[model samples]
Target: MHVPDGFINAPVSVAAGVVAAGAVAVSLRGARRELDEATAPLAGLVAAFIFAVQMLNFPVAAGTSGHLLGGALAAILVGPYTGVLCISVVLLMQGILFADGGLTALGVNITVMGVVTVVVAYALFRGLVKVLPRKRGSVTVASFAAALISVPAAACVFTAIYAIGGTTDVPVGKVLTAMVGVHVLIGIGEAVITMLTVGAVVAVRPDLVYGARGLAAPLKLRVGGELVDAPAARPVPVAARSPRAVWATGLVTALVLAGFVSFYASASPDGLEKVAADKGIDKNVEEHAAKDSPLADYGVKDITDARISGGLAGVIGVGVTVVAGTGIFWSVRRRRTTDAAPTHVPESV
Candidate 1:
């Protein structure tokens, strides 16, 4: 959920900012180990896809709706470190461009939504995949559970943050209960979306799915009435194959979802907004600093047609996020290459 400005006090918000910055720094380093020529573009696509799916909020309860938090999906498709970067980039774009999340509370949102979700979900996903059958279906199953748990974990983290720095006088108990209750329902939506997306990719090309990698069992051969491991097959370099088909398909899907399908998404408030309004958590809510921006609230300033304005904004958001994310990831990939290159020393003449 997007935490708006004034929900948390200045001191704690600043503290969270420091924590967020440190986590991002760590992730940047870790991502170097994860990204490559192929997966780097995939990571950028994951960010744009997350941004698009978030616009299609599905009804969760009477008046509450839920959207994909995307940590599990991203972590499964890419890697956890890159997944954190993916969600963080989406939140950054939404905050500065769409004026959706709060600028002041950016750290809080990143900590709860980006860091907490990725850590909890990826850890659980790894554990489950180890115990379950090492098959493609098992990865998808583990993804479901990981996604299901991550949402509530994030809710608990937000509750704790609010207890420490909430501006209102509301009881912490009520806030926790409401946040957990609604988010639990919301988690189902997250799980399904994560499951389907991961399954689809795993089905098409298991090589592309980070979590599904190495799941292919070694070939076996029967010789002299005994079974033994077959000779290792020559592996193809990741850089040799083209990822253009998958990348183009994913981009087109994101474009369609944002530009056409989002119009039918539920208009009701999301899980966090509903809980906040019900629990008086928004009593001290402040207006967004970018509220007057032309693209504020996911609509163009001069475009009067609701459909056209929202579609254009969504398209623009997808484009910008893809470009920014790709730039960042490609740079990281290049850095990885630079770090991995062997240095030469001249012999004494």
Candidate 2:
């Protein structure tokens, strides 16, 4: 959920800011290892895709809808560290460009929406992959389960944060109950989206899926009525299938989702808003910082037509987020280069 400015007190807000900053810093280093020519570009596309899918909010319960949080999806599609950055980038873009989330509460939003979700979801994902049957479908199953757990985990974290720094004096127990209960339903949507998306990607390019790496079981063959593992069979990465083609396809998919499909998103309150209203958590909700910007509220300034304004905003957001995400990931790839620089052995040798 995108926390508003006044929802949390200044001290707690700033503390969360520090926590968010530290998380980003750690992710930056860890992402370096995961970012390369093969994966760096995917990172940008993943962020843009998450931004797009988040626009298509599906109805969860009465008066409540939910959207892809993208922590599990991104972690499965890309890597966990990059997944954190991906969600963080989306949160930043939504706050600054769309005026959906507040600038002052950026840290709170990232902590709950990015860091917590990625950490919790990735952990569950890895655990499930280990215990479940090591098949392509298992990855989808793990992605679903992990994403399901992550949403409620994030809700619990928010309840705790509110308990400590909530501006209003709502009953913490009530808030917790409402938050967890509603988000559990929301989590199902998250799981389905995650599973379908991961399954689709794996079907096309399993290598692009970070969690699918090293999951290639030895090929089994029937030799003279005996079932035996083939000695020549080897893991084939999605990149080996066609790296450029995969990147192009991913970019196209991202654009389609953001440019056109997002326009028809359900216009209803999301899980957080519904819960907040029901539990009296909105009493201290503050305004967004960029609420008056030209593109504020996901509308282009000076555009009268709702479709055109929203479409342009969505397009601009996708373009800007992809560019910004690509920049971050490209820099990560470059760091990987510098970290493993070839030792000097000039022609003089």
Candidate 3:
């Protein structure tokens, strides 16, 4: 959920900001090991795709809708540290460019939607994969289960944050119950989307799926009536396609989803909005600082046709987010490469 300004007081907001900053810092360091030549570009595409899919909000309960939080999907497809950065990029873009989330509450949104979701979902996903059958299908199952739990976990975190710094006086227990209840329904949608997306990626390129790496069943050999590890298989040379092809395909898909498909998203309030209204959480909500921008509210300024305005805005958002995300990841990859480069010492004369 995109928390708007005035929902939390200044002190708590600043505290969340510090927490968000620390999380991003830690993720940056961890991402160095996660992003390589094959996966670094995919990370950017993942961010753009998440930004696109989030635009297509599906109906959850009566008069309520929800969209992909992208933490599980990203973590399963990419890596957890990179997943956090991906979502944080999307939230930043939405807040500054689309005015979808408030600038003042950026930290709150990042903490709930980015850090908490990624941490909880990825941890659960790893655990489930370990216990479940080590197959491609198991990865999808784990992705679903992880995503399902992450949404409610995020809701609980938000509720706790609100309890501490909520602008309005309301029954914390009621808010917690309602938030968890509605998000559970929303979680179903999240699980399905995550499973389908992760499954698709695993089918095409399991190597690219961070969670699916090294999941192939180990080879076994029988020696002296006992089972033992077999020698490593020879590397097979398949007709390899360039990563550019995959990146191009992913970018095209993102554009299609955001540019046209988003037009059909449900108009009802999302889980967060509905709960906020029901619990009086929006009583002190303030206007977004970027509300008057040209691309504010996901529409181009002075554009009469709703379809064209929204379509242009969506396309622009995808373009900008992809570029920004790619730049960030490329720099991270470069830093990693530079760090890994060998350093030579001068010979003693």
Candidate 4:
């Protein structure tokens, strides 16, 4: 949920901003270990894909809709640290470019949506994968459960934050109940989307899916009625097993989803918006600072055709987000390489 400005007071919002800043800082360091030559670029595409899928909000209740939060999907595909960065990038883009989330409340949004979701989902996913059968299918199953749980977990976090700094005097219990209830329905959609996306990636390139790595059991061969461990398989050549194909396919899919499919997304308000309106949480909500931007509200300024305007905005968002995310991840990957490089010391002459 994109928390608009004025929903939280200045002091609490600033405190949340510090917390968000610290999280991003820690994740940046952790991401150094997660990013690699193949994954660094792939991570960018994942961010873009999440940005696109989030546009296709599905109906959750009579007046509430939900979209992919992308934390579990990202963590499963890449890693948790990188997943947090991915969501942060998407949230930053949406707030500044689309005027969807509040600039002032950016920290609150990141803490609740990016940090909390990624941490909770990834931790649960790891636990489930450990106990479940170590098969590809198990990863997908775990992804579904993790994603389903993450949504409500995020809702609870938001409720807690609101309880502390909510602008209105609404009953905290009521807010918690409504928020958790609607988000539970939303979580199912999140689970399905995460499961399908993770399954698809794991099928095509398990190596690219961080959670699926090391999941395949050693090959066994029957030798005169006795099963023995098979010889180790040779590593595939880098050229022969490139991630370009997967990257291109993912980018194309993202383009299709955001550029065209988003037109059919439910027009109803999302879970948070619905809850806020119902509970008077928006009584003090302020207008977005970027509301006048050309691409504000996911539409191009002065574009009469709704389809064309929205399509252009979506395409632009995908392009910008991919570029920005790739740059950040590639830099992180480079830093990791530098850190791992051997340093030489000259002998005393």
Candidate 5:
């Protein structure tokens, strides 16, 4: 959920900002270990995809809706460190460009939606995968469960933050109950979406899925009625076309989802919005700083056609996020490569 300004007092908000900044710094370092040539570009695509899917909010209750928080999906597809960065980029873009989240509450949103969700989901996902059967299906199952839990975990974190710094007088217990209850329902939708997306990627390119790596069992052979490890197979040549094919397909899918399908998303308020209203969390909410931006509220300024305006905004968001994310990831990957390169010692002679 995107926290707006004034919901949390200045002291707590600034503290969260510091925490968020530190987390991002740590993630950047961790991501260097996670990203390589093959996966670096994919990381950017993962962010864009998450941005697109989040636009299609599905109805959770009579008046409440939910969208993909995308922690599990991104972590399963990429890696946790990169996943945190991915969601953070989306939150930043939405806050500054679309005014969907408040600038002052950026840290709160990043902490709850990016750091907490990614950390919790990835931890649970790894645990589940370790105990379950090491099959592709198991990864999907783990993904679903991880996503299901992450939403409520984020809600609990938000509740705790509110307890410390909430501007309203609402009881902390009541706020926690309502936030967790609605988010649980929202978590179901998150689980399904994560399962399907992770399953699809694992099916097409398990190598690209960071969580699925090393899950494949070694080849076995039966010799003299005893099973023994098979000889290592010869490396198969990757067609020059495969990588481009997958990238093209994924980018196209993201474009379609954001540009065409988002128009059909439920218009009702999302889980956090609904809970805030019912629990009085919005009593002190302030207007977004970017509220007057041309692309504010996911619509083009002076655009009368709701469909066209929203579609253009969505498309623009996807493009910008992809470019920004790719630039960040590619630079990280390059730096990692440079660091790993051999350094020559000269002048000893």
Candidate 6:
């Protein structure tokens, strides 16, 4: 959930912000190890896809709705480090450009929504894959479970934060119970989305899915009535899996979802916003810093038609997020190049 400004005290907010910054810094370095010529573009598309799916909020309970968190999906599609970056970028873009999330309390969003989700989901995914049968189906199953748990874990974290810094005088127990209860329903949607998306990518390009790596069972062979396992081999580099086709397909899908499909997204407040309103936590909410922006609230300023305005906003968001994500990933990739230096000369020469 995006914690708006004034929800948390200044000291806690600043502290969370610092933690978010440090997580991003660490992710950038880790991403350098994960990105390459081919998967670099995939990283950007993953961000765009997350942005798109987030627009389509599904009904979770009696008047409560939720959307894909995308941490597990992104971590499975790209690497975990890059997954964290993708969500962070989306959160940042939404806060600054769309006025969806809060700018002042961005750190809480990143910490709870970005880092915590990735860590919890990926860990659960890995744990499941290790014990389950090493098959493609197992990967998908693990993904579903991982995604299911991550949302509630994130909710717990937010509950703790609210306990420490909530502006309202509401009891912490009520907040925690309501937050966890609603988010668990939300987690079901997250799990399904994560499973389907991961299954699709793993089916076509398992090598590109970081979480699926090393999960492939060794090729078994029967030689003269004796069964034996094939020797271990490193997987093909993700760059060899063909990037242009996937990138093109992903871009088209993003365009379709944002430009046309978004018209059908649920017309209800998401889990956090609804809870805040009902629980009196939203009383102190401040106006978004970017409220005056033309593209604020996911609508074009001058576009009269609701469909057209929202469509334009979605398209623009996809384009900007993809460009921004690609640029950040490429920069991280480039930093790994070995520094040029003078060659040593032999003393005899």
lDDT of 1: 0.93
TM-score of each: 0.98, 0.94, 0.96, 0.98, 0.98, 0.94
Predictions: Cα RMSD each: 1.0, 2.2, 1.7, 1.1, 1.2, 2.2
lDDT for each residue of candidate 2 in 1-349, tens digit (9 for 90 to 100): 7787888899999999999999999999999988778789889988998998888888877788888888889888888899999999999999888898778888999999999999999999999889888789899999999999999999999999999999888999998998899889989999998999899889987877999998878788999999998888565765565567776777777777777887888778888888788877788777777888888988899999988788788888888988999999999889889989988877874
Clashes of 2: 1
- Supply the TM-score for candidate 3: 0.96
Clashes of each: 0, 1, 0, 0, 0, 0
Against the reference, the lDDT scores of all candidates come to 0.93, 0.88, 0.92, 0.94, 0.91, 0.88
Give the poorly placed runs of model 2, Cα more than 4 Å off.
221-229, 232-240, 345-349
lDDT of predicted model 6: 0.88
Which structure is stronger by TM-score: 1 or 5?
1
Model 6, C-alpha of 334: deviation from truth (Å): 0.9
Question: What tens digits encode model 3's per-residue C-alpha lDDT throughout 63-156?
Answer: 9999989988988888999999999999999999999987888999999999999999999999988999888999999999999999999999
lDDT of 6 by residue, 172-233 (tens): 88888889999999999999999988888888877778888888788988999998998777
Off by over 4 Å in 5: 237-242
Worst 10 residues of 6 by lDDT: 335-344
lDDT for residue 271 in candidate 3, whole number 0-100: 90
Lowest summed-lDDT stretch of 10 residues in model 5?
A: 235-244
Better of 2 and 5 by lDDT: 5
Compose the digit string of candidate 4's lDDT tens values, residues 74-118: 988999999999999999999999998899999999999999999
| Candidate 5 local lDDT, 22-78, one digit each (tens) | 999999999999997778888888899999999999998999999999988888788
Candidate 6: regions farther than 4 A off: 231-240, 339-349
